[model samples]
Target: MQITASTVSLTVDDVAASRAFLTTHLGYTVQAAADGFASLTRTDAVDIVLLARGTEVLPPEQRDQHATGLILAFTLDGGLQDQEKRLRDAGVEITMPLREEPWGERLFQITDPNGVIIQFVEWVTPDDV
Candidate 1:
């Protein structure tokens, strides 16, 4: 099957809080929203759907599960440092400091209001490795 689009649905304790965090800080626009759900989208990133914990739209077994131990990562083409600084300057707490790995991966992380861990990464050639 050919996939046309991608989306990740996250169940959170507070849908509005996660919605606002993504829209205001992470550049996601609201595609749709309801009392206990929100669909967010971005031109350069994956679409996100936030559902309040216990929302009936989810399967019975998944309704009460909050997104935990999950890290949503986005790989950037460039400007990883500038983006990190921009978020920091905008008052977003850098949950994980930006660092480069020996494998040529540079990354940093931030946790949204609902505790969703979002990580941004950029790859570059590491010298002497």
Candidate 2:
């Protein structure tokens, strides 16, 4: 199969809230939007689709489910510290402070209004595995 792109669909209580957060803070632009749905895009990141919980477009079994226990992580080639500082300066609360692991991974996390965790990671050394 030839896949051209990727997207993450999130079932949120407030689609507008999540949409605004992504556009305002995360450098995403609204590609399209409607009463209960929004499609956001960032040139260098994965596209995000926010669907209001219980929206009819979702399958009956999935409509009642909300996005949880998931972390939307972005891996950076460098500038992990700079990115963290920029986010902090922009008044974004750092739920997980920047920390480095013994395995040469550095990461930090932030939670959006809908409780979606966004993690930024940088590898100090190339993965050996």
- How much is the lDDT of residue 121 in candidate 1? 95
User: Which ranges of candidate 2 are over 4 A from the true structure?
Assistant: 126-129
lDDT of 1 by residue, 8-103 (tens): 999999999999889998899999999999999998888999999999879999989999999999999999999999999999999999999988
User: Each model's C-alpha lDDT?
Assistant: 0.94, 0.92
- Considering every candidate listed, which one attains the maximal TM-score? 1
Ten contiguous residues minimizing lDDT sum, candidate 1: 120-129
The C-alpha RMSD of each candidate to the native structure, in angstroms, is: 1.1, 2.0
lDDT of 2 at 30: 96
Model 2 residue 29 lDDT score: 97
Tens digits of lDDT, candidate 2, 1-129: 998789999999999998888888889999999998999998899999999999999999999899999999999999999989998999989999999887889999989999999999998863664
